[model samples]
Target: MTWARIMAPLSGGQGDPPTIAAAVALAEPFGAELACVYTPADVADVMPWMGEGFLGGVQTTALESLKEATAVGEGNARKAAAASGYAKTHFIGLQTPVWAGLSAESRLSDVVVFTSDPARGRGPLAEAFQQMVADEQRPVLVARPGLKVGGVVAVAWDGGKEASRAARLATPILERASRVVILAAPKASSRSFDPNRLKAYYAARGVSADVEVLSDSGDAAPGLLKAAGAAGADILVAGAFGHPRLQEFIFGGTTRTLLGTDGPSLFLSH
Candidate 1:
C-alpha cells in the first residue's frame, strides 16, 4: 500500500534537513500529498505568566515571537517543497504544543517523518514522535542525519503481528529499494520464520531480497544492526511496542535498543 497522505513535521532545528528530505523523497515517487506541518516554538512555555500590570509587555513579545517563527517555517517549507518537486502550496502554521499538534496531525496523515537523532533539543518532539509510533499504530519514518532518499531498506522480521504490520506499511518504500533484506533469527521454537514469503511478496512487485538469520544472540537488536550494516542498509524497518512504560520506552527491548541514542533512520509501526 502506498502512502497517499504524508505529513512531515518541521521542528526548526539542525536535524530538519534529513527529516524533510526523506519525507519529500518518499512522497515524490508516489505523487502523494506532502504537507509540511510547521509547529512553532512553544512560546507560552518560554513566556512566563505575569500580573495584569505586565500584560502589555507579554502580549507584545509573544506576538513578535510568533510572527518570526511563522516566517521561518514558511521559508523552510518553501525550500523543502521546491527540493522535493512538490507544488508550492498551502503551508499551515499551527501555534500549538509540539506533542499535541503532531498527535492530531498524525491521525489525519498516512505517515509522519522525524529525524532519529536521539540528541534532541529541549523540545518535546522527540518523545512525541516516539509516543506516536508506540501508541498510534501508524508508520513513522525516522530519518538519520545525512539520510539518502532511497537505498538498502532492511526489515527487522520476527514473525509477529507488529513486524508483519511494519512490513506491510513499508511495502511501497520497499518496492523502490535498491536492496531488501530480512533480518531474522530464531524466535519461538514452535514457529518457523522464513523470508521466502516476504521475498516473494517483494519479487511480485519487482524487488529482490536477501535473508540472513542472525546467530542466536538472545538480544536481537545488536545482531539486527550488524546484519543491516553488512547489507549496506541505511533505513531500518521494525515494529514498536504498543505501550512501553516510561523506562522501557527509553531503554528496554528491541525498539529501545535500536533507537537508543540514534544510529540509523528507523521506520516503525505498532
Candidate 2:
C-alpha cells in the first residue's frame, strides 16, 4: 500500500502552520499530494435557530459576517500552504455545503491530518477532527510538533478489530519506517493474542518488525508511550476507540490518555 494523497483540513487558526508542516512532511516521503482544505463556519447551520420572526436586516448582517469570515479564513489557509514550499500542495476552499465537501475530500484522500489541539477539542478544527475520526471513519494522523513520517514506528495491538484495521491501513507507513515495533500488553487487555502474529503479518509485506511484550498493568497507554519513547519512535500506529456522545465523541480510556499526551504523533484509524 502506498499513499498518493494526504488531506489536511485547516480552520484558518493558529493550528494551520503546524498542521501544514506535518502534512508536507508526510507527503514528501511518498511524493504525495498535500490537499489543504479551508473549513469555515457554515451560515446555514445558524439559520434554522434564528426563528421565522427574525428581522431581515439581522439575517443579512449575519450572512455578511459569515461571508467575510470565510474569505479571511481562506486567505490565511492559502498563505499557510504556500509557506510550506511544497510543490505538490493544493488549497481548497469549501462552499456553502462545507461539511459535504470536506467529507468528499477525506473520502478520496489516503489519510487525514490533524493537530493535537483539534484532537483535544481545544481548537477551531475540533468538530471537523471528530467528524473525520468517528463519523467518517477515516484514517487520521494526529500530528505533534516536529512530526516526522519515515522514522521508527510503533504499533499498539490488542487482537481487536479496531487494532487490526489500524495496522492494515498503516502498512504503507510501516513499510517506509526505519524500524517497526509491535507493543502488546496481553495482561492489560481482556483478549488473548500473540504479538508475533502481527510481526509475521508485517513480514509478509516485506516489512520486518520486533515484538515487545509490556508488563502487566491496569492501563496500557502509559506503558505504550514509555516504550515508544524509549525506541525514539516518530509515530505510533493505533486504533482510535471512541463513540459518539451527544455532539462530541468520547474516546476510550487508553485512547484518551494517548491523545492527551504530547509524546508522539499518532496514526489512528477507527
- Ten consecutive residues with minimal summed lDDT in candidate 1? 116-125
lDDT of 1 by residue, 129-218 (tens): 655676565688877765554688899887778888998888888877888888887752235777777777777877788887777557
Each model's TM-score? Answer: 0.76, 0.97
Q: How many residue pairs clash in each candidate?
A: 0, 0
For candidate 2, write residues 79-181 as lDDT tens digits. Answer: 9989999999999999878889999999999999998998898877889999999989999999987688778999999989989999999999999899999
Instruction: Identify the runs in model 2 with alpha carbons over 4 angstroms from their true place.
Output: 53-55
**Judged by lDDT against the true structure, how good is candidate 1?**
0.70
- Each prediction's Cα lDDT score? 0.70, 0.91
- Please report the candidate that would top TM-score against the real structure: 2
